[model samples]
Target chain A: MRIAFAGNPNSGKTTMYNALTGRSEKVGNWGGVTVGSKEYPIKEEYTGGKEVVAVDLPGAYSMSPFTPEEGITSEYVRTANPDAIVNIVDATNLSRSLFFTTQLLELGIPVVVALNKSDINEKEGTKIDVKKLSEKLKCPVFETTSTEGKGLKDVISNAIELVGGGQSAPYVQADINLQNKAEVDAEDRKRFSFVNDIVANVEKREMLSSETTKSDKLDGVLTNPIAGILVFAAVMWAVFWVSQAWLGPLVADWLVGWIETFQEWVAGKLENSPAILSALLADGIVGGVGAVVGFLPLVMVMYFLIALLEDCGYMARVSAVMDPIFKRVGLSGKSVIPVVIGTGCGIPAIMACRTIRDERERRATSMLATFIPCGAKIPVIALFAGAFFAGAGWVSTLSYFFGLLLIFLGALLIKYITGYKYRKSFFIMELPKWKMPSLKFAFKSMMERAKAYIIKAATIILICNTVVQIMQTFDWHFNVVEEGAENTSILASIASPFAILLIPLGFGVWQLAAAAITGFIAKENVVGTLAVVYGLTAFIDVDELEMTGGANNVAMATGLTSVTALAYLFFNLYTPPCFAAIGAMNSEMKSRAWLWGAIGLQLGTGYTVAFLIHQFGTLFTEGHFGNAFIPGLIAVAIMATAVILIGRKTRAHFDEKYRLHRDGKSGAAA
Target chain B: MLLNAEPGKTYTVKEINTDDEEMNSFLFRLGCYVGEPITLISKKKKSCIVAIKDGRYNLDELLSSAIIV
Candidate 1:
C-alpha cells in the first residue's frame, strides 16, 4: 500500500509518520530539506502480504506552489498516485488547514483527515466536527493526537480500508475550471471564494476570542518601531544562546572524543607505511576533510534546532515581526533567511538563495551570505578562544557578532551601490502557524543536512586534500631542502605568495598563512593542513601535550594572543567564502566577467576591512592608533554613508534624478 | 485617481473597498489575495516597502508601478 502524509508546517505530519514507522527510518538528502519528501516503509505483521511505503512530504498550507515545499508536496499528491493520502491538519487551526484540504480534494483522491494537535485544540477551546467535515468532503476523517499517541489505530485502519477503494473526497471542482483556460477561463479567478464558503459552514467559532488574539496584542508592541527592535534583539540573544551555550560545546566535546578514537585507530593501521598511511589517513582523507567532518555532530545539532523552529513556523513569525527594520535596509523580512542560515554554511545558505528570485536582492543576499561565518570556519574562532582568549565564551560570541555586524554593513553597501536601479524586486510572503516541532522532523532534517555536508566533504574536500598532499610531496624550491625538513617542505613552497597577503591580518607566519590560503578551497582543510605541516597527528597526543620546538605543541601552534587570534577569526569570517561560493557566483550570475567582478568585490571588501583592522587595531593593544588606520575608518564611514543614502533611495521607488534618467530613454522616443 | 498615489508619498492600506473594479479583479486573480492589504512602507529613489497582509515586501519601481494601489 502506498500512502502519503501531506500537510503544512506544524501540522504533525512528521510526528504522525514517526509514530507509524518508529525506528525503521531511512532518510536521504531531499534537495536541501525545506521542501524534500522523506519516504519510509511499514511492514504489516498479521497480513504478511504487502509492505506499505508511506512518504512524509514537507508541510505547506496551500497547494499554490508558492514555496518549494508547496511545489514538492502538491506535485507528489497529483502525480505519485498514492493509494491514500492522510492530509494532517492542526485541529486548532482548522479554518486555515481546511484551505489545503479543499485543494487536496481537488486532486481527485480520498484524503483521510488526520486531525493532529487535538490535545492543544481542546485547551484552546476549539471544536472540530470531523464527521461533518468528512461528510462535507465525502471521505473519512479521524482526530489524532500524534504527540500523545491518540487515535493512530483508527486513522491507519481507515487509511488501509480506503486504499484501492477508489473513493473521491467531497471537494467542489470549479464548475467552470477555465473551460478553455485561455478565453473567459476567468472564473478560475475566484481563488478563495471556496475557502470563504467552506469556513463559513465549518467554523464553530465565528470571531477570534480575546485570548486567541494574543498574537495581535503582542504584535502591536512587538512590531512597533521601538518595541519590535527590542524584541528582535531578544530573539537574536535566544538564537545565540541556543546555538552556542545549549548545543555547540557539548556536541563539540562528544565529537572530539569520537574523532580521537578514529585518529588513534588510523594511526595504528598506518604506522609502518608513512607515505601510504599519511596519504590515506592524514592528508588524503582526515587531514583534508576529516577534521571538518568531525564537527558534523555539532553542525547537525545546529541544523536540527533550526529545522525544528522552521517546521513549527517560529522563524516566519520572526520575519513578520521584523518587517519594519528590513524595510529600512531595503530588504523584506524574509531576506533574513540567508543571513540566519548563512551563519551555518555559506554553501547551503547560498543554495537557499533559490527561495529568493529577485536578481538584485539575490545578489545582495549572496554578498551578505559571505559575511556570516559558517560552521567550517567556526573552528578558527573556537581555536582562538581556547588557546589564547582563556576559552572565554564571550570572546567567541564577539566573533559571531563581528560577522553579523559586517553582514549588516555589507547589506547597506550593496544597497548603496546597486540601488537595484535597473532591475525590479518584490516580496510577497506567507506566515505559518506556530506549534511544537517534532523530534522526528528535527532528526530527519538534521540527517538530511548532514548528508549534504558528508557528500561535500567526500568529494570536493577529499579532492582538495589529495591535491595538497600530491603537490607538497614535490619540492617547489628545486629540492634544495631535504624531504622531511621542518620549515622547508613542499607545502611551504606553494604557500609563499598568500603568506604575504596575511601579513596585514597579523600572524601571517608561514603555517598559519598557508592554512588560510588552503582554506579558500574548503575551510575545513585548515586543521588537516596544520596537522600535516606541524606533524601533530602522530607525534604528539592531546593527552601528553609533550614538548615540541622549545614549547608545548599546543602552545607553539597557539602562540598568538587572543586579540590577534580574534583578528584572524574576524578576517577569515569576513573573507571571501570557499571556492564553492565562487562557483555559486558563476552559476548565479552566469557571466564570467560578473563572477570575476564578484570575486573582486569579495576580495576587496575582505582585504579592505581586515587591512583597516590590522593597520589601526594596534591602538587597542598599545593605546596609540596608527596613521594607516585613519583611511580605513574613512572607508568604513564613506561606505556607511553611501548605504544610508542608498537605503533611502531603495526604500523610495524611483526618485526624480534617476527617474529622469529612466524616462530620458523614452524622451528620445517622444 | 489611485488613492495615495503621490509621486513621493507612501501610505499603509487602512480600508480597501472591495468595490474598486480594476484593483479587486487584479488581486482576486492573484488568488484570494484581498485579505492581505499592503502598506506603502517607504518610497526611496526607485524602490518601495509594501507591507502585504502579515509580510513586508520590497518592490522596485517597475513592479510597484503594476500594483494599482
Candidate 2:
C-alpha cells in the first residue's frame, strides 16, 4: 500500500514523512523545500510489519496549483491512486489549514489528519478539540510533533488501518460549471466559509494571530531594507570565512596530513614494482584522489552552516529582504536561495529554481545561479591563490565580488535577450515562526553531502586523473615520453589547437588548455588535472607549500604570470558548470532553446571576462596589451554582435505580438 | 486602502483589485478574499507584512496596494 502525505506549504508534511520513512529529504523551515515527490518504504516499526510505501509530496494549498512544485503535489494525488493519504495540518493555523483539509476530504481517499506542530499550540495556550474536529471532518485527527518524532506511530498506524476505506466529506460543493470563473469563485467562497465555521466551533485561541509577537519584533530589524541587506552580507561573509579561511582550513590541514601519510604508505609498498606501475597506482590514484578529498572538511563545514540557516526560518526573511533588489534585475527574492545554494553545489541550486512561480524567472535563475563559484571550484581558486599570489585573501574575495557583479549583469542581459517587459511580478512569502536551529539535523545534512562529495571524488576525479596521467606519460607512438619531450605527448597535441585560441587571454600553454577542457566534466578536474599533468601533489597543504617555497616552484612550473593566473581562474569559474549541472539546467529549463542559449551565454561570458582581465591587467602592469590582442578583440566583438542581434530579434517578435493584440487581431504568438 | 492601513489593526478585505485572475485566485486560497478579515502586522517602504487567518506573509508594495481593505 502506498500512502501519500500532503498539506499546505510549511505544514510539516515532509517532516512527518521523514520521521516515518527514516529518510532525510531536505526538510527546511520554509515553503517548497521538497520540490519533487519522493517515496520510500515506511519503517517496519511504524507499519506493524505491513508492506507500506510512504510518498512525500510537495506541499500545496489546494487542488489548483500555483507554482510548478505545487503542481507536482496536486497532480500526483489526483492521478495516483494511493491507498491512503496523511494530511499533515499545521495545528497553530487550524483556520487556514482546514481549508485544505476540506478539499482533501472531498477526494474520497481516506485521509488521517496529523495536526503537526501541536507543541507550539500547547505553549501558546491554543486548544483544539481533536475528537470534535475529527467528528466534524469525518476523519481521524492525531496531534503530532514531527521534529521530535512524537505521535508519529499513532498517525502511521491509523493511516495503515484506514487504507482501502472510504472518506465522507462533511460539506460538499454543489455542482457548478467548472469552466465559468464566477461559478468556481462562488464555490470556493462557500468552501472557505465552511472551513471557517468548523474552525470557529472546535478551536479556541488565547491570543489572536494578528497581534505582534517576538518573531515579528525580530523581523523588523532583520527584514528592514537597509539593515537586512547589511545583515545578509555579514552572515554570508561569516559563512565563507569560517569555512574557507578560519575553521575550515584548520580542519583541512589535519585531514591533509593524514592523506599524505597514506600516500607515502602506498608509495613505499609499491617501491619494488615497475616505475610506471608505482606512478599509476600511488600518484595517479591515491595522490590525485587525496588532493581532492583533502578539501572535504571545508565543504562539509559550509553545508552544516547552510543547513542550520535553512532550518531556522530565516531563509524566508532573507528572500523578502532581497526581493526588491533582485526584482530590479529581472529576478526575485526566490532567486537568492538558488544562488546561495549554488555556492555549495550547482546541481541542487538549479533544482531549487522550481519554487519560482514565473517560468521566465525560474529559467533565468537556473542559468545564472552557477555564476556564483561552487564548492567544486574552491580547489581551483585555492590553487591559483596559493601558486600565484602568496595565498592572498583578496584573491578569493575579489572572485566572489566579481561573481556577484556578473550575476547582475547576466540577469540584465537575459532580460534583454528574452524581451521581458515590465510585468507586475508579485512577491509574497509566508513568514514561518523562528526556532532554534537543530544541531543534529544540521549534522545529518552535513554527513549526507559529505558522502556525495567522497563518491564524486572516488569516481569522476579518480578516472580523469588517471586518464590525464596516462596521456602525459606516453607519446603518440606508445613509448613513454622522455623528460623535456612532453610537448610531443597525446595530451599536449590535442590541447595545442585550443591553446592557440586562448593565446589572446595569456597562458596559452597546452597543459593549461587541457585543464580547462577537463573542467567542463567537473570543476574539480581543473585542480586534479593540473596536479596530474604538473606532477604537483600538495595543492591542499597551503601552509606547507608556503613554508618550503613550493608555491614559487609551482608558479614557475605553470609558466604563468600573476595577471594571467587570475584570468585563468576566472575562465574556469564563469564557464558552464559540469555536464551533470547542465543536465540539471536542462531539466529545470525544459526548453532546448533556453538550454543551448544558457550554455552559449556562459561560454561567451567566460571568454569575454578572461580576455578583458588579461588584456587590461597586462596593459596596467606591463604597459602593453597581452599577446594576440587583435584576435581577442575580434572574438569579443563577434560575441557582442550576436547578443545585440538576438536581443533585437526578440524585441521585434514581442512588438509584433502586442501590435496584433492592439489592432484586435488574434494574438496567436503565445 | 491596505497600503495606508494602520499596523496591528484588522480590517475586512473589500476586494482584490488586480487584473491578473491567477494572482487573485492564488490570494483567495490563502483566505485573503472579499469580506475576509486581514491584519496589517507591519509596514515597510517597499513591502508590508500582513496576517490572514493564522499565517503571516510579506507582500511587496505592488501586491499590498492591490488589496482594498
CA RMSD per model (angstroms) = 8.0, 2.0
Clash pairs (backbone) in predicted model 2: none
Task: After superposing candidate 1 on the true structure, give the runs of residues whose Cα lies further than 4 Å from its correct spot.
Answer: A1-33, A36-85, A146-203, A206-221, A238-313, A351-359, A421-488, A507-510, A536-555, A558-564, A578-600, A619-670, B1-69
Q: Score the docking of each candidate (DockQ).
A: 0.12, 0.89
Let me know the DockQ for model 2. Answer: 0.89
Give lDDT tens digits, candidate 2, residues A380-432.
88778777887665676677768878999999999888887657799999999
Fnat: each model in turn: 0.14, 0.84
Please tell me which predicted candidate would have the highest TM-score against the true structure: 2
Most accurate candidate by DockQ: 2
- The TM-score of the first chain in every model comes to 0.73, 0.97
Instruction: Please report, as a residue range, the 10-residue window in candidate 2 chain A with the lowest summed lDDT.
Output: A541-550
Which lDDT tens digits does candidate 1 get at residues B1-69? 122365323343333344434333333333324233345544444444444422233343444555565
TM-score of the candidate numbered 1? Answer: 0.71
Q: Candidate 1: how many backbone clashes?
A: 12
TM-scores, in order shown? 0.71, 0.97
